[model samples]
Target: MSDIFNTSIIFKSSIFATPVYGPTTIGNMLWFFIILVLAVIIAKIVSLNLNRFLKDRVRKNDLNLITKAAYWLIFSIGFLTALPNLHVDLSGILVAGGIVGIIIGFAAQSVVANLISGIFLIFEQPLKIGDNVLIEDTLIIVEDIRIFSTIGKTFEGIYVRIPNEKIFTTTITNYVANTARRFEYAVEIRYQDDAARAIQIIEALIEDEPFCLKKPGPSVFVDELAADGVIIKTRIWAPSEVWWDIRTTMLWKIKCALEKDGMEIPFPQRTIWVNLDDGDSTPKKTIPERNHVAEVRIHTCKPSHPALEKSHPNSITAYNGPDESDKE
Candidate 1:
């Protein structure tokens, strides 16, 4: 064991006096280990400080990204420094890595797109965690934003993972983005009902709701003359947090108040008239009785077809038949 420990090897034109393995000396190996340990310690310290600095100013996702980038950067620098100390050549490795990087870039276009889009989202801050948003047809509450995807918990209590690229490219409606939101409802009443009375009822109901805003005030007006009734449109503003609650509750209240006041909400209706007898008729003929004998005759004719008249002894004809010359 002593001989093995004391064994010496020499290579021509080597820089180190003693060789542990290949061209590397024991001292160099020790130094490399020390550098690696130092790298880890420094990386941890830098990451903690970076997290602290970014905690208040940036989103959690962005903070995490910065911290990870810091740690990796420090570790990579340390690794490159140690590699030089160990006499490793990186020229061929860098060339190979460049070629591989190009192939990977082509293969992972979508992945790269998502990553870049996620970075932009973090910087833009269009939405945050716990925000209610409508993306296209999906309504969701944001749960987490990651580098490649965004996680959302839907109103139905289901978790959804959307790629960052899709989120960045689509239209996003953030319900909680503003402090106040407006809601409109069209209430219909019978055409005979008083429009002013219905409007007053709706305005009163909106005023009673605590969530409704007063500075901008609520609006009520006749919107249109519908077939069944008059449309009274009501517009109100409320705090975003309670907008939905106020909208639903106030509509019910308005409807109940209108009904209680004898306002009618008319349904679709139609009217039709019919005649019992055929409407087409010619002038009537009156006969004078000479020998105390009176007789009356009745005839009916349709517009499409005329009926033949019965001959009376003292009757007068109102219509003359077509002339023979006219027929020819």
Candidate 2:
């Protein structure tokens, strides 16, 4: 037992005096390694805790980046603290690192901008995952938000990747951001049909639909008396989640109800009159449906003038308007 203790002491003295690199001895190197190992373990534990804390607060990609950055930051601090034990000059390394950092910053200007913008987006939260948003005229459902870019799927099923800088700078229209939304429709009915009745029918239909919100209610009134028909404007408020379905379904139901009540949409009509060579001043009216050509023919009229009766009693006059085709 005495020999073993003496041998251990001798080994320790030799290790402490042995030079490994520069003025650093084996003992210093061992201490450096021990510090590094401890740093790694501490970094891992801190990162794990940070990840757990931020798991639900931030996006998946953002959480991952934040945890990794934190881990590396702690490890780097530990490494720098343990580096002086080797008796190395850190000033030269710091100067070199500063130069490299400047060079990298200049080289990755856009990348840095995107990263900064992404950080702002995380806090601002203009649009979240699964939000129906329109960014720069491209409508999409946000799938994931990352440090530098955002991933989404368009309504047409096309995948899109948008940079965080652009997303942060541009305007975004989030459809479902509000609890309720409003949609309007300009329904046309025949001029002969009752406008008040049409409005009532639309109001009734809106009342029947459960998705339509009752707080804001609905507005149905005669908006315009157009040439073709009476335009009944209907503005309805509904829950944002089911507003689209209500809009589509309600319009069809309104049409069916109006049609069932003997209300039909009317086509444009114009009246035309032709003067006769005789003393008759009565006018001829012609009403034609849309897309149909009108046939015009003059009828023989009994002449009251005595001189025209001898000259040409069979003479007739006819006037017709040009074919009118309306494109909806």
Candidate 3:
């Protein structure tokens, strides 16, 4: 046991005396720490300069990425230079690291894809922080953009975390990208009401709104003639910030104005007709009864105009007279 102890003490002393590149024993370790400190300081300086240089060229979202990359690059060079001084073989370590990296790459392929997409997003600047956007049918306000994911606050006041890969591939509607937005509505009025008068009323209503833009002007026209009424279409442009407010309020205002003008918004209307004997002086069918019951046939026809009949030969016209059988 004494001999083994003596051998261990000799081995340790030999190691302590041997020079590892430069200073031996504890001195070399202290120097290594000092070199690391210097590396940190140099990395910080490089990062600061890189940030300053890219301040104008790059977007604010990419500033952090650029500085982080600069710092890591400088730090890695310093680490590699100091690594040889440690007197340890690094070939095996490098090989093992490569193998581990390959395994991780296969295991976390999606994570890597998200990271790459995040980088593209920061550079492209399709959306910035605090922008209102619609993604996957959800309207949200962007909060923070990270390397792997983006965070958003939904209109419902909930936080949503979307992977950068998904965001990059999906369609994003940026509502605030443009200064102005358009809104349209179809106002229905009775066929008896004058369409020209209705249009004039709507134009006046739109002109009165402060948010509505005048240069482009508002459009009010008869768009369609339906079975029940005429559809008056109104289209107007407004600032994006006030688009929602204007859209919600203008409709009610128009409704009130039209009603005050005695214009009626019509509902579905249908007309029916019945045939009776006028010569009998009683409400009874003229046709002969078969087996103690009168045989009667009914026909339906849609009311049409001369203009419509000229355009559509097959269109059914209004009932003109009773059928030949009833006449007989």
Question: Pairing residues by index, what is the TM-score of model 2?
Answer: 0.65
Specify the highest-lDDT model's number: 2
Clashing pairs in 1: none
Cα-based RMSD of candidate 1: 15.2
Worst 10 residues of 2 by lDDT: 293-302
User: Which digits, one per residue and each the tens of the lDDT, describe model 3 over residues 74-166?
Assistant: 888777777655654589778998999889889999998999999899889788887899988878998888889999999889999999999
Local error of candidate 2 at residue 64 (angstroms): 8.5
Model 1, 165-261: lDDT tens digits are 9999999999988899999998999777899988988888887888889967888999999876799999999998889898888888888999999
Note the clash tally of each candidate: 0, 0, 0
Q: Write candidate 2's Cα lDDT for 62-95 as tens digits.
A: 6776888888998998898898878878898889
Candidate 1: where is the Cα deviation over 4 Å?
Answer: 1-98, 271-328
Q: Residue 45 in candidate 1 has what lDDT? A: 99
Ranking by TM-score: 2, 1, 3
Off by over 4 Å in 2: 1-98, 271-328
